[model samples]
Target: MEIIRWQDDNIVLLNGAEKRPMGKCEAQAVSTLLVIKERMGEDSQLTLLGCAVGATAAFTGFHRATVSRHGPDVLQRPEKQKTMKEMGKKERARHIASKLTMPQRAFLVKEIHNIWADKKYVRVESLWEWAKANISYKYKKTYFFWTLKGLGFVFRKLNNMTVVEERPDIAKLRVAYLKKKKDMDESNAFYGAFDETWVHDGMAPTSGWQHANTTMYKKARMVDIESAQSGPAKGKQRGKRGIVLAILTEDGVLPGSEEILVDDDDENNQKADYHGVMDSNKFKEYMSRCIPEFSRLAASKGRPGVFIIDNAPYHNATREKPPTQTSKKADIQQWLKNNGVSYEAKAKKPELMGTLKNFLTRNGGRQAFTVYEFDEWADEVEGVKILRLPPYHCYWNPIEFLWAQMKATIRGMGSVTDSLPIVRDRALDTLRKFSPSQAAALFRHTRQSEDDVRGMLEERESVEEDTSFELLYEVDEEGVMRNVHISDDDSSEYVDFSDISDFDSTQ
Candidate 1:
């Protein structure tokens, strides 16, 4: 073929009178062949008119010097190129492993193991921060976490001794709760979560900046008394605590729904636990007052409202108690009669239970036996539905997160000198400042947590069903998983750290 030609912004090969468009690969091939022919010699019959590097460059849209320099390498065998790439990758891996010394590497692994031993879950960011503070680690966060993975430390959910979470009953409850939540979500229902939290004047920020020379300590003073005669002097006076109840929705805290009950100054009335301050009666009153407004808000959005709360004892107080096996046969018969189910009066307790079970199985199963007062009240509300969070699954409630944010803000605004009134005001101010967008974000986070828990439950069920596939791993005392063979080798360390260099410490 004649020398490659650039025609109308297109590379074309010219041969006598015929011209054909040359693609990128074709141009590269022709350039590589021309370079090979020139290297061969002028006597070689294969050299039909050696192509110039400048012309090839113009045809391929590459610089003339680049064509001349890399054109010969283009003829290099593919196997050799692949080998070079593989060698580069191996060298890169070696260089990365050499960044930390063996001792430093061991120290990191030990620290992580210790953390997992004490805590159920630890984030990589927390580990990175610990390394920076304790070991003077100067590498980027990504590299530090990558090094942890290389040492056989995986960022996975660790199994702890949370027997309640693993219980079959609780698992069923979680599955049901997820199903209800999924239905509500698919129907675009409005979500509102309400929970009670306590805040005391002694509450302070967990962390803050301090002067290098001065130590900041949290200190509180008791209420002053004029004389011992003044109603029997206070006994080790404590800061007042407030019981706060609030309704949080996707649009933020409902207006006029926040209620705070400050502890009485009287010594005789104070209780050891905050739960004593708020009872079923008070909770019922609060819900009665706020739920109507919540209904109206949901109606305005043109969607049904779901009010979620945890299964606190007070929240689950029944309007009517269901008869248990220990109850009298008369009581069981009466219960069955009250629920419109007919049963033999003279039947023994076992037969009565069998009949009751059959009836309940048709109607909502065991849950139908007892009707929660809160559920009854919510039923009366037009557009609102009550959802109790599954046992030990309080994280599914977005209000829990809202309460956390409120307390954090309150503590940040408070000091040792703050009184109950001041703390209450600060909490109310924080609630006021919590915007709709922030509440929406919290709801999104709660939804994600729900999804994660659902996935975990499904995975557990699948694993349980597949008996042939046993997970061949055991968790050690440090919460690290190991293969049986690896666990048996006591001579080997938990992690091999010789590959990591000590460069960070030197810096």
Candidate 2:
């Protein structure tokens, strides 16, 4: 007797201590012979059956039978055999996709490309949703996904290794900042870095000891047991928010320079972040109060002071707004006159704008027009200067590290049940503990970062200069092109359109 067992996608034939794998065709042939033998008893003649079937039945230890009981019509037909050669799963999916006309396929590919370009990454479900809405796709989502895969679409997680600091413009800014710092160091200027941060009463240590069998939740806060049992809606809030403005110098954190503003309004407390609570006006008011202390500290050191501040929007509030093409003619005229720029009395808006652009270009561009109010205020105090740090380069600011140390210390001593006042007090105490040695160490670390960035910029510039090449060609009257040699001093002149606005162009 022959026993056939299915293993995965193949058929295994076991017969009397012998076993062998069989293809689909061989298995079908064996099954057909077994059915024929069952229909016609073993006593019937075997010659009527095909020689192939008789041989297969004998090899598999099955008795051969004649087809006398049932006519030859019992055999598998040619059409049935043809149907067995149908397409496989993947082939069928591709065939379904091919049903769309060429233009339709092109349209889908273009739309999918556009979506991916805009979003950087997309999911199969999102593509399907878009297709259903835009193209009225009638196929199942799984089939659509398969079609996408067949068309060379693949899913992958987006990479986040790239950063803004790697850009050429940002690198140039870093180099310029380092050069300025170098000059300041040579002048023996005092560096005082200042920044703002926020904290909440729910703040706690990110790590702690816990039971071996239990999981630990960092920053977990205490909640009312009865209310939590009822539902999340009845649980206590995260905590009250406090915005802190701090200053740190080589001598240590300036006394009375730590200002903590607690959000007492219920509506404000419900907000996720506290940045909106502080703005340019509030920041200006705070600076007004701290400038005197800053001046005193610099005098004590007997060195010129350079107030290093990050380029926060609030810190860069303009004293006077710059005029644009959209400004009224009177406003533009007044601005030009105040800046001592001469223009035709009957000059149109566009002409006046052109005159203004020339004046600004000769000076320092739009930056010269937009002067920060804080910078002007700082200039009032002798021996004090304001220096804005390059954007996205927070490591260059020592106050940032000071804030981190203060927060860590506060979190380590804070409790979930602590009130806003307790949290504020803890933060103040932590700030008080920051010694001059710690502040100096942070400043040294910042200086090291500056050196590293300077090295990076120098290396990048060397590589760029080594690889830089230019091809200049000239076409003679005979329409023949040839390479043109030019000296380094022979520079081409081009119009400066950077300061030109859309409105100016239209005019």
Candidate 3:
């Protein structure tokens, strides 16, 4: 083969005729010129343009340098081909869709994630409408949904709830409170936490087992006590018609205290004083008497009581005052009856107010009430200096977990019944099994969660989003596609790069 050498603007065929060379080739063809420059110069071009012999892929770069650079494959970058192979499905889809407009395509992915983050379901039609409104690209709802599904997206139920972002101020206050409690606890005191939960016939939630292959699930059963009406239960025994009030401590139920049942039948029963559900008056009487009795028991064992309790309305530091109108007079009468205060039911408004105020003064008045009983018998009574968990912070309470375990046991029992005796016995039996060691173990779970929350609340100097707007896709359960929520704090999910298509145009 005769070699062709380039002169200024012309090509010389050493063994043939000289000819004027073609001008610079297309910008798109600059890359492939390196692949065959040496061979093209020596004899033939890469291809004959069409069927005519003279037509060929013309070279553009300087002859000597181009041949040298193109001669070795190792000198060139493999980035273009590698990028195509490693590109995620969503990324490639975004790129293809970007032909219409890059901004809209990029914006749509971000909007989908934003809608999902807001806990609003993004339907296909909604996304299609949004794109139509924002861009000139017209897309059918069906087409968009199908394309998204094909590109790896599935309806995934959200499982995480936004927790209260712990501020350093809030954590500081909690630390101070905790330190105060610890100082009080270090004395000769029995550290006892109290929480209340309502137990009814259907409070035990039954769980259903499903086979691994079952693709569809029916509606799930929910244990919603609030939804239960006062009417007779359908096709089943009546639910236990009362509240079970019990206090828990380290060892077990407070000494000399049994689970108190408050229901309709209590008012007409022997000890009329203890009948009915919890109210402000009933709560005050219980605190002044029942808790004091428990405190005595704690003192007997060489420990005063240190009660850890929640702040329910009945356990408020101040009680509400009753209005004195005829309609409201009955309210004060009811309060008197509930607290077992001896008073004339037909008494005038002024007389009734004076008597009630006197009684409230003897007990804990609205102004004087700290919700802690002042009893000097257990030595510095003031209701044993109660420690309160922060509002909405249930992670510090272990009794909540205890209630869950008891309910689980009740659900698992084959002989579980709504009948009073059976329900009462099962509940009491469950409570009896809660030893001090079990309480310690369960409380550790709460303690660990507290530590995790505290660690998460550290002052950060810099923060950033996990995403750089990369079109990421995730999958679970073998081909079940799920939309991944990427967080800077989470590093578990890996973006899938299985999707690839022809990128020769880009190459």
- lDDT score at residue 211, model 3, on the 0-100 scale: 42
Q: Sort by lDDT, best first: what order?
A: 1, 2, 3
Please give me the total number of clashing residue pairs in predicted model 3. Answer: 1
Residue 399's C-alpha lDDT in candidate 1?
83
Candidate 2 wrong stretches, greater than 4 Å? 1-163, 166-175, 211-238, 267-276, 330-347, 350-365, 465-507
Question: Backbone clash tally for model 1?
Answer: 6
The stretch of ten residues in a row with the least summed lDDT in candidate 1 is 227-236
Residue lDDT tens for model 3, 375-471:
2322365446566665566657777778777766765662334555666667777887778788767656655555544433331212354333333
lDDT of 2 by residue, 1-507 (tens): 444433342334654336766678877966875676557754334554434335435555554443212213322223431121264654444444554444455566767656655756666788777776777666666667756754444455654333544565555566667888988988998888888887777677656754443322221223433321221112123567888888888988888888799777564445554556877889888888887788888888888888999887778878886589899988899999998888899999999988888887666456547778899888775447888786677768899888888887877776666677888888887787789999998988887666655654555566644222122233343433333222332123222323323212210
- lDDT, model 2, position 92: 42
Clashes of each: 6, 0, 1
Residue-level lDDT for 95 in candidate 1: 37
TM-score of 1: 0.59
lDDT tens readout by residue for model 1, 352-434:
98898778666655654667878877877555788888777777788888888888787766676777788888888888778
Work out the TM-score per prediction.
0.59, 0.52, 0.43
User: Which model, 2 or 3, shows the larger TM-score?
Assistant: 2
Error of 1 at 78 (Å): 15
In order, the Cα lDDT scores of the candidates are 0.67, 0.65, 0.52
